[model samples]
Target: MKHCRTRLLTACLGLSALTAPAFAQQACAPRYPPPTTIAAMFDMAAVTADTLDALPDVDVVLAARGGQDLSKYGLRHSHLAFLVRNDQGSWDVVHLLNRCKTDHSDLYREGLVNLVGESSITTDLRVGVPTPAVRGALKALLAGAAPQARALHEPRYSMLAYPGSTEYQNSNQWILEVTAAAMAQSGDGTVLDDRKRTLDWLKQRGYTPSRMHIGIGKRLGARFFADNVAVTDHPASERISGNYSVVTVESVFDFLHRSGALERELSIPHQTPVPAVTGTASPRQASSP
Candidate 1:
């Protein structure tokens, strides 16, 4: 894995944090200041991008950020996306985002800085290096295969969407399905192009969704107040226990690592009090990944 040293600036700006689309599905309320400043967020993204740029012959990598702190639920990072290198020698983040206060979502292509600054609750950037074959497939699908990538997106958004169901999809679920679509190849060189086929391929490959323990009070609250969260797509047995299975950053990375699809993992930490110098800051391997 490659590493880079980046400086974090402490310039104070009254920059408001953007509302998280699906990662942080809390009750409707007033927004609060993010944990890190905009300058630190940009610096964290720069560190990540520079690390990728330092790698030899790398094109696509899995990047994730921490949005809402779900430590109570045993979760850290909230959302994940693919960072694909473009011809201009820069990276673009491709992921799914729910429309503002709506139950539908759309695919978005933005910069790494925008992704890191989206209501991030932590300063660390988590990245996964996929196997060479998987990286090649993802790079091809995300960079040049626009129509093929669009076909995997399902507009209906649900924070607790089931991995096996097609009724609704969460943000991480779309990335998982697209990953399956990229890896599901045939002898004749055909790949899974639709959600159903990709989902089936995921199941066949033994992909598992993370089970979140949402208590009765929170479940009932989200039932009535949360527009972007839904549990109807989950099976009755799981929903009755107040623990719904949903796709998450940890689950997706675990699947990739256990299935031998990932080659290495790296963690880029950011601290506001650190000196603003381009000194050597080596990223460590994540214990969980």
Candidate 2:
């Protein structure tokens, strides 16, 4: 769901391809969010924090945001991450972020506020509380067994990476793989050693990916112009038809729900301030000590 399409398809492919590299080496320009937007985002972050704080029985949960307009796909949230309860009792976000305009990605650990930064489309936050056993395992995986957790990420990134392939990975795909590995951990401490095993574990659990139908025109455009979208890693049969079984936030959430991995789901709405009356104090001022 990382928007890495910095360059659009120009008039002449030959000239543009030759002059401009396939990928942009530098990160995309920072967006200057309006003050009001920033305030709203902070408000959403605060509400999200409060919601997570209320989940006393959960140590790790899935957090998602509406980063993109995915209504066409019947999806709400466009990105997903794990919120692990830190020693300080605050939650921290762990997720994969693709290097801007590149076919590469890296794991990032940030605070809840950063995860909800500059809200797009919507400021509503989705949280999935895992079953107690699953939560404990995930907490252990991301904390005590962090190296093993980090090893699960495949650096090569693709927007529509196949759910069953290790050639490339999308952000949500990484979470699925890691969750498989976490679930595969045995009481004896044995764990799935690699991505292949994790994928197999997911298959055994009946994990289903979201099937997206990309038209030929859009497929061609992505293939030729987008570095973060690839078809080579996908099954030829599926690729040729322009339908891809890719991992998405909704797909992963459905899988977890079906597998009895998630015990609860909730959405925290963005708390916007009420309009101030002509001579009244703002909400912030009224709430102040």
Candidate 3:
């Protein structure tokens, strides 16, 4: 009777021990919070951008010391400039202007998609040989091919522009003149040589030379805008306006390729690794140290 009682007790203990972890896990397992809505995401980006803009210029520099905080402000305007992951495990942007909204869906298709009509910086250069891996990844994105682990070897591109006005004409002309001067200073031979190459490239692509415009915007304050609106026949024009630090697409690709974001994106697998179980004794450890 004593032996049977002891065995029964031992069995009960074992059963409890076996079931405890399952129970504990059920109690402790994380309940993922509700997914953020598209509107909420856009609001966050706007707040972030506004806060960034409001900070002292020096403070902005400090906050962005090594990474994207600075770049984000420079590259993005009211549009959803940064990327966020959704509950369904996809990356998306929340464009504030409803630029990406379509009748078919409220949530825009995310990841490696392109702006309608024009090729992004990555797609435009991918067909050429001796292309960098980052460039290839960007190309893959523009082509809707796949996400790459590597950073793209290309400068970022944006289609946004300030509203047009003839009042800012002088400011616009100044922007072009500055661009030409910079191109002249940076070229291997003469500014004319580089201009010829650029013009030829544009011509080969069937771009109308007369439609090219370079100008500064009064609305943008001191910034300059360079655009190729004629190529696409867009009435508002496609322009990029910023300080001299901003490089042309060719320069941007060369720099990004050298920086290794492209290679990293390509080589790294998408799935993050599950952490190894820590502090648990293995079967062998249960027997000995």
Q: For this target, which candidate reaches the highest TM-score against the unseen true structure?
A: 2
- What are the candidates' C-alpha RMSDs? 10.1, 11.2, 22.7
Q: lDDT per residue, candidate 1, 242-277, as tens digits?
A: 878889998999898888888899887853633345
Between the candidate structures 1 and 2, which one is better when assessed by TM-score? 2
**lDDT (C-alpha) at residue 36 in model 1:** 45
Tens digit per residue, CA lDDT, model 2, 1-289 = 1111111111122113223322122245556566566555555655566667667787788888877677898887888988877676656677887866698887766656556765522567888888887787888888853777777788899989998888998989888877777666733355975788788888977999999999999999998999999979888989889888989998898898887788889988855644434687889999999
Kindly provide the TM-score of model 3 when superposed on the true structure, using C-alpha atoms: 0.19
Ranking by lDDT: 1, 2, 3
Q: What value of lDDT does candidate 1 attain over all alpha carbons?
A: 0.73
The lDDT for every candidate, in the order shown, is 0.73, 0.73, 0.25
Q: Give the TM-score of candidate 1.
A: 0.80
Pick the winner on TM-score between candidates 2 and 3. Answer: 2
Off by over 4 Å in 1: 1-36, 118-121, 186-190, 273-289
* Cα lDDT for residue 244, candidate 3: 24
Output the lDDT of residue 91, model 3.
29
User: What TM value does model 2 have?
Assistant: 0.81
